[model samples]
Target: MRLSFFLLFLTCSVFALNIDISNSTIANGKTALLEFKKEKNISYEKIVVDKKTYKIFDNPINSEMSYVLLPISYYEKPSKKKVELFYKEAKKQKTKTLFFKIEDAKYKKEKIKVDGSKVTLSKEDSKRASKEYAEAMQIYKTTNEKSYISQSFILPLNTKITSEFGKARVYNDSLKGYHSGTDFRAKVGTPLIACNDGLVVLATDRFYSGGSVIVDHGQGVYSCYYHMSKLDVQKGTIVKRGELLGLSGDSGRVTGPHLHFSFRVGGEQVDPLQLMKLINKNLLNK
Candidate 1:
């Protein structure tokens, strides 16, 4: 008699991953930009962009990179649009780059432009804004949250976007600027809500943000509400979802009453519209 033994082996296929771009084409006076970075050993060329978001029909003639799609804009000058790209591979890389190819409605390389009036900051003001931007980027580079899986992020304030994001802003009659956040047009003293279940990172008043609230929504995803009439939450306070955080008002550099709401996803400034879409798709529809 003889005894025999056999072993069975199985292998699982490993697939490469990337963040694809969606709806990248634009009109002549418009531009499309996608931010991406090189990952170790990962072919950037294998990355396929979201046609709806990226508008790319074929593969790039050159380069292999992993990229993240960003907000697009229409401008008048050839100024570089900037964004932060965070990558991790047993290590980390925090880099900023101008990534995109702009095309007209005719599909030609349109020259991207910028309106210099958007920033009317003095030397001192520029320094301060630069410092704040750096701190926010550091937070994104260190936070570990992986992706936008949360169903609905609570609104910083229960209100409508009166001014809209990225609109050409005119501060006072003399100073001109671009609106960095979506302005929720609300009545004075309207109750504001916390955008997420996170610890209060900053709660204070300043010359520009006026009475502002910044909450660290874990993973470097921070939400800020500004131009507040009142502040109910204090720094270091743990706020629950939909918690009463403040009241709306024309507190900061504004012409009328409104709640200026802003969001930072992994340190990149993204359109709040995406958040609404996520809520509708995952929360309401689900």
Candidate 2:
């Protein structure tokens, strides 16, 4: 899928900058790719979306083509918003704005009865959970200049999807939580693969997630694998896309054995399916 920034905003007023959007209608919890190329001696300093700044990434397919990626948070409301672009030409600073149509998306509600103890945590478990959450959040917020993932990603196992991202789960019809990851049905000892090339940031069994592995794909993007029966990789271990990481099982508070796979971008949970589709579209050049 070529992201043509050609003659964008034909129905709207054109900005003074050379910019084109990857899509006109962007759904919530999705990503947006911007194709941008600087004029001779004129380049952008930063790209702003919803008051947050983003760095420009070089298009791996075409060196001359630069792009900006936006990972819209699931909490973002549907509306028309403006993206600000700041650039400098011949030492002169300038800025331009582009509008995007964002739509709302709904997730499937799920209700499952699990152990009452799982829903209610003790004082010790609460403290441990808090610390673990903070650690994971820090990893998600970490920024790296170089993109560690260069190629396409592969599924951990070839199995049917049993659960989806953003799925809302109500435990015992009381405790509610959102399913921030995608789940694939896999039996015990099913070999799991790393989605892309990255260093293992965390590989340990926790209270809720059980055996989990979080890979830092650099550039504020991370992939997570949870509820594994066995983990082969360690912290700081570099893994390829198809490299074995572990096996999937019902080690956590799950009803059955499955691989709960997910991705985090810019500290927000996004749809793994949409993320993979956008990534595959970009990797078509390979």
Candidate 3:
């Protein structure tokens, strides 16, 4: 009885540690979760592990919650050992908790373990995958669209990010590569807003994106809002900033209700927070 009790206590203590990026043993490019526990907020530079170093991103504006998806090269392989994280804070600031999760082959192929399962995408929908990348590029270049100069991009939905961007995933038993967007957790009818004002070029239900909405915010900046409950705007419709475009829900390949938001500058998928840091929040406040 004493041994069992001790084991239970140890388990609880480990969980209470609240460390992110703990499950790195499963696969590469897994989300590294770390908590910044400190007496006060402090700005430090870089996280160092196994003599390998990583730099902290620089930005002017920031949100309460943020995440980044790194390539597989960011982590060490084999034993799936724990790597140490270092911090670079601009000023001494208090850090409460940081948590992490990694997406592996097993995680991607599994269906929703929770009850009340709803299908978001079907096999037949594959016919409409984005075959017109060239057309999207053409519209992105030829138009006098408004460029996104804001430092902080708004959350496409009102809820928290359920699934992070760039997580490795498997869809329909096929191993998909790195995730391209951030998933916002919300109910079936939560309002989905436009992060910035731009032209609605592509608005269609996709097999994977599901009830997807793509907006070109000029200067080759494009934001894709996916897994919507409903789409209120149409293609070619000019939308204003913060316009009500749709509602958040599980419309695509997902386990629960969330909005998958992705930002593309040209063809590469850069960090959404980078754009957020560039845009001024004062304009939105007005």
Candidate 2, residue 248: Cα displacement in angstroms equals 1.0
Q: Following a full C-alpha superposition, what root-mean-square deviation does model 2 have from the true structure?
A: 2.7
lDDT value, residue 68 of candidate 1: 33
lDDT of each: 0.52, 0.79, 0.52
On lDDT, the leading prediction is: 2
Q: Arrange candidates, best TM-score first.
A: 2, 1, 3
lDDT of 3: 0.52
lDDT of 2 at 100: 79
Candidate 3: regions farther than 4 A off: 1-125, 130-152, 171-174, 279-286
User: Candidate 1 regions off by >4 Å?
Assistant: 1-151, 172-175, 279-286
Candidate 3 is scored at a TM of: 0.51
- Candidate 3: 10-residue stretch with minimal lDDT: 1-10
| Stretches of model 2 off by over 4 angstroms after superposition | 1-3, 6-16, 283-286
Q: Candidate 1, which ten residues in sequence have the lowest lDDT sum?
A: 1-10
| Residue 98's lDDT in candidate 2 | 69
- CA displacement after TM-score superposition, residue 168 of candidate 2 (Å): 1.7
